[model samples]
Target: MGKLGLVKARHLVSRTGMGAEWATIQRYKNLTMNDAVAHTLSYVDYTLPRPPRTSSWTKTVGNRKSVSRQRNMMRMSKNEGAALQTWWANHMLTTKTPFLERMTLFWSNHFPSTIAGTKQPSALYHQNVMLRKNALGNYGNMLMAVSKDPAMLIYLDGYSNIKDDPNENFAREVLELFTMGGTVYYSENDIKNAARAFTGWSIDDRTGKFINRPEQHDTGVKTFMGKRGNFNGDDILKILLQHPRTAETIAEKMWKEFINTSRPNPGYTRKWAHIFRTSNYDIKTLLTAVLTSDVFWHPANMGGLIKSPVELAIGTMRTLPYRLRKNNLAHNLSLMGQSLFAQPSVKGWDGGESWISTQSLMRRSGLMTNLTRGNLRGKHDPLFMRHMPECSDEELMAWLIPVKPLHPLPTQPGRQRLVRALVLDPAYQVS
Candidate 1:
């Protein structure tokens, strides 16, 4: 791969790290594949923003240590959550490497839940944290963690389930969406049976603590995946994780997220599947194999995928020499159908072609104009710098929108005209 190829690779992985800046890419310019893999993994905890303040319901519990009360605290107002979002945008743009942030964003979509409904900003933020923590670890462990996540619990109505009448939402989604992708690894009978297993799974109203009420649970044995047993939600997850289809489903997602190519390379997927299962689902090992694969850096794949709203928003922010605020940044992302911690449904956003449409393209174009013209105020206000204190105009343009200039900009011109022409160009519409 040449310099451009390196830039492409860095951008692709930014889905795992958001989009690493040019300076960060330059640091690893000469690293061998193995060395680069190690270097990247070392960036899991590269840098982070301060924790955001959470919401608290008026019905306050004096005991701050209680999960219910804590959950309430996490569900702060939109204004409060804005601070945290700002922190995130700043960190991602400025971090030496944002691989974990990008990876967390990917998993958030994959496992898709919305904190908006639950009003639990803290739990939502915590779920994001958990995703980052395990984004590149063990799939089984991560799945289990997501299953119990407070944000997920509330988002999927797991908190409303009881022994007498199981909600069935979480149980159905766990098999159909989270692990198996609705391929009949499980059946309706299995869903009913699984719901019984998860009876009494509820959360504290004020505090967001998950509780298992034995009285609400059905202890009767039932069959799942052709196996007969009294299975609970955890048992269902375990069965799915142990199934071959489970491995296949997860491997396919890895292929799309890291590869982002049109069709899946089954040969590549299978090679990684064997490694994933053999290594007990180690994420790092699987990613290492994929990233080091020859096809990942191929020229044919460059700019082949459309940038998700999140990617377009963050990539622009990182490349441009500017800043943004939390609310404005969140607002732009929301307009793009990818607000952090707020997905449309349990299935999450269907990536790839789903992000492209006439309306979406228009919104992206509008955002570009606003960003470059200093008209937009996101998490980091002034997300662009027309007057670089040090670098020349050409260098600033190259730094900010390196993918493909929206237009051929003059070295010096009215910032308004230059930004408008470049942002309106088709290249800015694609990655």
Candidate 2:
């Protein structure tokens, strides 16, 4: 078997563990690749920790945001977002189901929406629930769930859609960004039809629940993608899945993440697209196929992806033992440009090289410097056990990435300095 422990640490875990956690992977050294993959998926069945519900933030029974409530909502939502990020970091650091968490994060960006823009924390929390619930389960079910998600309804202006005036924001994005992937694959006519198909699709303002208003719905025929008949949001999704281009778009997206590169290998992507279509969008089936595929382990695609802020931070927390307060951890990440649910736009953060700019890199290093020193606690804060001077530079890199290295780390230091350097290195910045 290939290095099951190494592959698990690199692709699945947010940050590979050290000490006892590391030992557990080594203990499975003899596990076949198939067995190890099965082990990873089985972990997804484990129960995850739940954060406080955002719906409970208010005392009033109705969904109205009173003047005082609005003021509190503005202030408290920031902390709520931070706490959620902290919970995510803790799960990545400690859970056996890191692959599932990783998938949850992937879907979060793939269906990009932000709590800051929604102005309703409860909706955002539930949207996250929707993503996690179907992270590796089924893309079609996930699509249906997100199409009716409260946070998504607010973010995409689905609440504004009505029989009298169809709002095209959500429909346009669903086609351009979510399914077809670009304008070339669809036309403006398709967008209008899709929007009309979702008329009266809105959320309950008080409870942040999805509700279909029959009176507001246009129960007439919608010519979506040239197919004519009375159709609604669910029907549109089913129709969209029938298009071969939609399957190709999803496969290409997943391939980018799996292979760690922006460039598409058409031959390999088409293969996965076939699997996705034939499997009826079974997410776990496609992912399992990709992970077991030879392309995933190719040297050209390994260790080159730039780490998003969440990955950079969570990886650190996993490798080292630190009990950082969730709020502070969230604040630090915000400064680095990724604030959990507060994405800057509906398109989500531009990953890859976009994650690194001159300013952001400095900020990233600064964050690393703070974590290395004891900013997590007080001055001279105790975190690590001792120096790992005996660990070769090659070995250290192996802990963070899947590829064999071109060279060893030039700088050698005590355990603390090694960590600081690793965290700051351009190599460590990537997956």
| Best-performing candidate as measured by lDDT | 2
The estimated TM-scores of all candidates read 0.82, 0.86
Off by over 4 Å in 1: 1-16, 57-87, 205-207, 374-425, 428-431
Tens digits of per-residue lDDT for model 2 on 1-431?
66555555444333222121344455544565576566666666446678755545234223344664666666566666656766655666666656677778788988977867776666676787779889978898899999998778878999889989999999999998788889997789989988988999887655657899889988988788878999988999998999988888888887767667577788988888889999999987787777778777565656656777777776566555544555576666777887778777877776777878898889888777766664222224343544232355565556644454334543544555555555556666766
TM-score of 1: 0.82
Taking the tens digit of each residue's C-alpha lDDT, what string does model 1 give over 1-431?
A: 33333554354444345544556555564565567667777665634567766654323334245776665445444555566566565565656556777777778888876656656566777777788888878889999888877778877878767776778888898888777776556679888888788777766655666667777778898888789887777887888888776776777887777666477788888788788888888888878877777777665654556678777777767754534554577677778776666678777887777777788777887787666665333224332334322445454344334366645665555554554555567755444
The numbered model that scores best in TM-score is: 2
RMSD of each: 5.5, 4.1
Worst 10 residues of 2 by lDDT: 12-21
Candidate 2 has what TM-score?
0.86
To one decimal, what is the Cα RMSD in angstroms of model 1 from the true structure? 5.5
Task: Count backbone overlaps in model 1.
Answer: 29
User: Please, what is the whole-model Cα lDDT of each candidate in the order they appear?
Assistant: 0.67, 0.71
Error of 1 at 31 (Å): 1.4
